[model samples]
Target chain A: MEQGIQIVSILIAGVIFYGGVGWLLDRWLGTMFWTPCGIIVGTALGVYWVVKKYGQAR
Target chain B: MGGFLIPLEGEWVSPGVHSFDSRPLFPGVLPDWVNGHLAQAVIGAALVIGFWLWVSRRQQIVPTKRQFVGEWLYDFVRNNISREALGPDYRKYHPYLLALFSFILVNNLFGEFFVFMFPTFSKIGYAYGLAVASWVLYNAAGIKRDGFGHYMKKMTLPEGVPIYMAWLIIPLEFLSNFIVRPFTLALRLFANLFAGHLVILVFVLGGTYLLTLKDNLFYNFSGGVSILFSFAIFALEIFIGALQAYIFTVLTAQYVHSSISEEH
Candidate 1:
């Protein structure tokens, strides 16, 4: 249950961060470029690095 | 069946349309009022289909003006997304990806045409289907690139990490990369389009609500402003809908690119 919660929590943050950045970039630059995609890949990689070393060990 | 009940005075029920307020508006179930979303979807689909049918029937290589416009948009997606993201092999994927992008772009923009203002992408199911298609392509491409064993390992392992870190990293990596990423893609598109539709709905509905107030000077003034704001939002929605579709397709293509790249 706790693990499930963690996964969901990570997802909420990912949505806000990725969607927020993409939206801001679109509003500012008036183009749908890599900002949204970058946020997704970046956050995905960051969590993978963090959890692989710390969370899974437990 | 759920088709028999239409409240003529208050609530109208339809397959895809729902009211914003969540109240049981149980009265006006007229065909004209209850099925707004489906009506819009049909009209939108018909317009695209009609345009294509007409264009294809009269297509020419000598550069008629209509053909030029069609070819321009077709080439835009092909070159920008298919060629750029997938490289030289993009020709094989161009048809599917191009259709996906244009279908979404048209459906999203269709909301601007009338009082029936629902962008099809705002429906989560459509976004989910599109996302799953991209997900399948990415994983399939990965498997094809590295073979099954290597693909799995590459996805779960980061380069230069300590061997002991595998315990923590693998699950997190697997979950984020393999499981949730596609869902986020779908939700992001769905939520943005959905919110945009909702804002338009509020503005239009606000105008209607204000106009319904007693026939006084203040009511008319407020109602006029509400109508103006709604029109402004409708215009913004046209741009936003196309932009969201473009963003969704480009990101999907990029994901496929990353999957097959040597850096992975």
Candidate 2:
């Protein structure tokens, strides 16, 4: 349960943080693609993060 | 089943978020903010302290019942949580982990037991308070052990990442480690206990309403089932309460362990 919460928080946090940034950029540039870009990048980064922290031989 | 739940003169009301409200213990005699939760919190803390003190004061090498119970609790926290997480440096943080686990366990059990019958952490503010304390504790321990510059660098910058990616990695790490860690920590505990208590209230209140107010015999049987099933809910609540307390304490130890470890 604890590991599940950790993974979910990282994923959700990444989305929210980058998505908010993308949203601000979209408002400034008057474009819709930035939000999607931000979300994808955020999710990838979140996955990479989990892999880095947990995928290694400890 | 209680008359007080149905009220004296008003129409029967269903259990809702209003059930979680912390009304003043004495309406006009004292401050309006002096509610049952505050009193109960104090009592919980007092009981934790008193129990540990009483149990630990007269420890027998052979171990009496009190000594055995105290030793078991302490060993579980110290070994299973602290030592398991913090490695050799677990001793210093053992006291905090023990206290936090015991206090939270007591407060969560308040929902199932008599007198209070309310889980204290259901209040988001209180949960946030504990989270903040934990945030301060882990950060303080990390900075103290690794120095400010070293600790910040370790937290925001994972090894083997290129310097060019620092712009992206820095903010992400900062947000995750500094912001989201404690946020999720508190919310997990609060949400579990809050939802569990709400579930119980639904069963108990709806059951009571069905049994007493309705004229039909079917409603009475269903109400009896609901009330009986609430015992299962109560058991589930107790399990959840203990689990939340354990998770909260384990996460705390994890944060501190990660912070103070030789590696980032």
Candidate 3:
């Protein structure tokens, strides 16, 4: 249960962190596309982090 | 059945988030700071402190009933939660773990009680406050145990990662550790209590509303059923309240353990 909550937090954190970056970039460049791209990338990275930290043999 | 036919004065409005809002217990006499949940929190704190004090006032070679209960609570948190989660260093943090468990459990049980039907944590601020405290404690412990720079590096840069992937991994690690931990911790507790209270409201109020629908025998029958189900839900709320308290305390211990441990 604790691990499950932590994993979820990581996923949300990833989206918020990278998505915020993407939004900032979009604002600077005046492009509408960067936000979605950032979210996708952020999610991918978040999943990767989860796998890296938790997926391996103990 | 005919006696139950009297109609309710107002429409049965299903409870929503607004249900959590507090009307001042004292309309104008009490200061603005004193509201239902705030008062409940204060009461909960007092109850926890008083109970512990009463239990610990006299040392016994054998044990009284009160002492037994107190010892059971202490041992439960110390052995089951802190020891199991924090390992050899658990004793260092036992007091904190015990306090947190008792405080939360009392406040949560408030929701099921008659006079104070609000779980203090259903208010998001209280949950966030506890989370922030835990966050600071764990991070500080980590930094204190390992040097600040070393801790930061260890937290952000995992072992066995490729050098080329450092850029990608660093930000993710930073966000996961620094940002997500507290956010999820608060949200999990807040959401559970908020939803649990809301569910109870729906069942009880809906059932009461149904009981007043005297025009239909079916409605009256189902209303009785709904009220009965609400009792079962009340029982569930109590169990969840205790479980959430345990879960929160255990996770806090785990975070502390991870922070101070040599291995991640």
Candidate 4:
């Protein structure tokens, strides 16, 4: 069940990050290519959150 | 071999000529000599280039029927990406930029999306290669346009910032403008493709898993749901694939435009 949930979350994250970022990049930069950049930024944000929480746990 | 109704399991191996671990990347090795990913990418590329060459064999003022289709696609990217992103000087850059758009569009659409089970763009290396190409092109163009010193200055220091804030803003600006942009450029494509492939994998595999569960009705229901979702995502993948390729190409052009324009 945990794995199932994780898969769901990842899929959700993938869709949101890909679609949202692509939309934002197109709007902000006037190009759809920036969408990929948004994904990278979102992933960085996710990584930062993980790192910060893991640090707090330690 | 068993009858057609029964399913079979096989070991995993990498997709192409490149061996992941001497086994087939996805069950049922395609024989050692056959290069899967490379063949697909190369053949896909060849087809696009060949089709254009075949269509445009003779130049025309008004364009023949076959040439019209090519012209329309070229014009679409030219207007949407080149002229739209870079503004005035886009005409000068249209040919190469058009090639980039078409190559990526075709590769992503046909090579990746049309494959049904496997999208070629899902490969991380392909995305990285594109990123590196983009990074090199923009940086080189910047340095070429305004010398190294001017280029660095434009990247590192902003025009309107107060003097005292230089200590703070300069480093942050440099990091965001120079360092993070290209890094994310590659990662953006890589992560999207990677994650997209994984989602499709999960649903497809889940469907298979449920189907294998001893003729249970619930399993059939879930399997049906998975198939429907998989097809839906597959359609969405077509849009995502083309959109990502377009965005990447245009952004590269935008970076070049910003760099050469000499204004903030």
Candidate 5:
């Protein structure tokens, strides 16, 4: 349960942080679709981080 | 069971977030700071302190029942939680871990107790306060052990990430470590206690309301059943209360361990 919570939190943190940045960049660049792309990228990165940090046998 | 669906004269509104409000125990006699939840916190602290004091005052080689229980709790926190999570250097943090566990356990159990029916952490502020304290402790420990520059690098920079990927990893690491850790810590505890108490309230209050329905045999019977089930919920709440305390303490220890460890 604790590991699950940590994973979900990391995913959420990734999406929020990167997605917010994407949204701002979209506004600056006069585009409208960067947010979702950012979220997807963020999620992949987040999962990689989790796998590296916690998924291995310690 | 279909007959139990008795139409009510008024809406049977379920208890909502407002149910967690901390009303003054005494309407006007005490100061405003003395509210139900605050009083419960004070009582919880007093209970923890008093219990430890009583146990520590009498050091028995052959322990009595009370002393045995007290020692068991201390050992559980010190050995099972702090030592397991913090590794070989766990002794320095045993006191904080034990205090945190005991204090949280008492406050969480307050909801189950007859006198104080509110868990203090349901207030959110208290949970955040504890989380911030843990946050500060871990970060300070890391910085103290490794200089501030080294600690920042260790925390925000991954061990094996390529230099090209540092842009993404750094921000994510920063947010995960510095921002999300404390936020999730506080929200996890506050949400669990708040939702747990709200569930009990729904059952108990709804059961009472159903029982009070006029001339409805099925509603009354179902209400009794609801109230009976609430006792089971109360048992689950107690388990969750203790489980959350352990989780919070262990996670804190893990965070501290991660902070002061040689590698991330």
Candidate 6:
């Protein structure tokens, strides 16, 4: 139950972090592609994080 | 806006977000932030402190009822939450864990049965304050256990990762660990309490309004049923309050464990 909340938090953090970056890059470079790209990459990173950290531990 | 529910004093006043607005106890004298919720939180703190002190006053060998109650509460946190998370180092963090559990539990309970039927944490500000405290506690625990530099490295980096991925991984870890953890913690507690209180208000307010409509048996019967059903909602709120307190404490312990543990 506890880890469930953390996992969801990590996923949201990924979106907020990279999505923010993507949004800034979009504004800077004047393009719309990087925003979605960043979101996908971020979600992948978050999944990797959850797998590496909580999966094998407890 | 579903304004049909309330038609009190010939004015339709729908129960919505305005239901959660904090009215100041003393409108002009004290600041708006120092409202009924703040008073409830203060009272809750006092109640928690007093209960612990009352229970732990004198020594007991076999154990008196009050001592047993205190011990039971202590062991619930110590064994189940702190020890379950932090292993041998659990004792170092048990005191904070105990206090966090009891404080949140008491404040959450304030919503159910009291002169002021409101949970202190329903206000997002109070939830954020508690989250910031938890954030500080976990980070400080990590820094104290390991040096700041080592703790940062462990928190951000995995056990084995290519140097090429540093740019991508570092920001992700930083956001997840530092920013989102506490944000979600506060959001979860605040949202649950706020929504639960709103639901109770919907039933009670709607029921009361409906019952007063002139000579309509259908409206009166439904209103009466809704009012009766609100008791069950109150019972559910009590359970959720206790569960949230448990979840919050356990998650804090988990974060502390993650921070101070050897492996990232």
The lDDT per prediction is 0.69, 0.87, 0.86, 0.64, 0.87, 0.86
Q: Summarize candidate 2's per-residue lDDT along B94-116 as a digit string, tens digits.
A: 99999999999999999999999
* Per-residue lDDT of model 1, residues B1-264, tens digit only: 133322222332322246432222233564443344545556666776776666566776697888887788888998878888788878766776776787778888766775554577687776887889888988998899899998888777767678886664565566666667688778888888888878776766665555555557687578669888888888888888888888778777766776787763
* Alpha-carbon RMSD, each predicted model: 12.4, 2.4, 2.5, 13.1, 4.1, 3.6
What does the TM-score come to for chain B in model 2?
A: 0.95
Across B87-186, the per-residue lDDT of candidate 6 in tens digits comes to 9988888989999999999999889986889888998999999999999999999999889998998878766667887777788778888999998889
- Evaluate residue A36 in candidate 6 and report its C-alpha lDDT on the 0 to 100 scale: 92
Q: Identify the superior model by TM-score, candidate 5 or candidate 6.
A: 6
Q: Flag the better candidate by DockQ, 4 or 5.
A: 5
TM-score of each: 0.69, 0.92, 0.91, 0.69, 0.90, 0.92
Residue A58 in model 5: lDDT: 65
Q: Assign candidate 5 its CAPRI class.
A: medium
Model 1 residue B74 CA deviation in Å? 1.2
Candidate 4 ranges beyond 4 A from true positions = A1-58, B1-35, B110-117
| Residue-wise C-alpha lDDT for candidate 4, range B1-264, written one tens digit per residue | 235424523332223323121223344545553446656667767877888798778979988899898778877888888888778887766766776666667666652344534455567676677777777777787898899999989876647656875564454445555655565666666666666666666677667666555658897788778978888877777788788787777777777676777664
Say which prediction, candidate 1 or candidate 2, comes out ahead on lDDT: 2
- Lowest summed lDDT over 10 consecutive residues: which window, candidate 2 chain B? B1-10
Off by over 4 Å in 3: A1-7, B1-8
Best by DockQ: 6
Who is ahead in lDDT, 4 or 6?
A: 6
For candidate 3, write residues A1-58 as lDDT tens digits. Answer: 5467668777887788789999999999999988999999989988988898789887
DockQ of every model listed? Answer: 0.05, 0.49, 0.62, 0.03, 0.55, 0.65
Candidate 5 lDDT, B103-185, residue by residue in tens: 99999999898888888998999999999999999999999999999999998886887888888888888888889999988
Candidate 6: segments with Cα more than 4 A from true spot: A1-6, A49-58, B1-9
Q: Which residue window of length 10 is worst by lDDT in model 5 chain B? A: B1-10
Q: In model 1 chain A, which range of ten residues has the least summed lDDT?
A: A1-10
